[model samples]
Target: MVLSQMDAGKALTAAAAKGNPEEVQRILEELRVHPDTLNEFGRTALQVMMMGNAKIAGLLLEKGADPNVQDKHGIAPAHDAARTGFLDTLQVLVEHGASVNLPDQNGALPIHIAIREGHRDVVEFLAPQSDLKHATVSGQTAVDVARASCVPHMMDALFAHVHS
Candidate 1:
């Protein structure tokens, strides 16, 4: 019953995975945990939220969790959100100063990850603000990744954004 006694990092991660804002805030208030604590895999609560927890992501950002923290894989929280096409999460991170251009270990930016995953809406959202010519691990840009993944709409969107 004592949420404070629970592992704050674990609780935060679980809350992030569940997108439970209330539980997350409770953990923060009761546990006095560091919001940016990384898990064994080097993922922070914000990163976990970016993976799929829009509510928790918003909460964490509103609570002042660092938006620029990277996982062990060197992927920023925004990158994870973009990779998963979590538009709301991405927006929250962005509003909190998450760098839109941070690259992952493979040199893939958030837009590149979104394109590789064939997330058309994410690509559409990111395209206007991104440099589609940016390269990745294999020297491929978002358009190249979209083309290889057979996502014609993403490729077209990137192309249009880059050209226009």
Candidate 2:
């Protein structure tokens, strides 16, 4: 009845991948799956939840998943949520203590990716939470990336938040 750690990890990621909240709960409670269990890519369950499973993600956090645990790309679940424009998911991650300004391997933060991908609404929502003045490893600010990536509305949004 008890699965090994490897099996449990597989089940956990599978449940999260399918966005199965109940199954995730069962896995956490019954199968003894660690909430921070990493997959082959070094992504924890919370990071996998960035595929858009807010419910499962919440359960993972409630079970002690570290919201700021970075994956292979050196970013956390919030980066995936931001990249995909999943505002609700991103908010959940942040609410669970995911650091907003943590940059990835490319020195791109969640806000930077949001802007570059033209998620204007996400950009608007996240810009205030961003340390836009903080330059990336490449030395580009969120505003600079906005201007360079041709996301004018994102640029405008960042500017508005700043000037306001």
Question: Native-vs-model 1 lDDT?
Answer: 0.77
On residues 56-85, what C-alpha lDDT tens digit does candidate 2 reach at each position? 878999999998888667977878888888
> Cα lDDT for residue 126, model 2?
86
The global C-alpha lDDT for each of the candidates, from Candidate 1 onward, is 0.77, 0.82
C-alpha root-mean-square deviation, candidate 2: 1.7
Write out the backbone clash pairs for model 2.
none
lDDT of 1 by residue, 1-164 (tens): 44332356777877777778788898777776778766555567887763666677777877779998987678888787877788877877887888878888988889988887877877788888777778887898877788788766776767777773
Give the root-mean-square deviation of each candidate in angstroms. Answer: 2.6, 1.7
Candidate 2 runs further than 4 Å off: none
Residue 154 in model 1: lDDT: 74
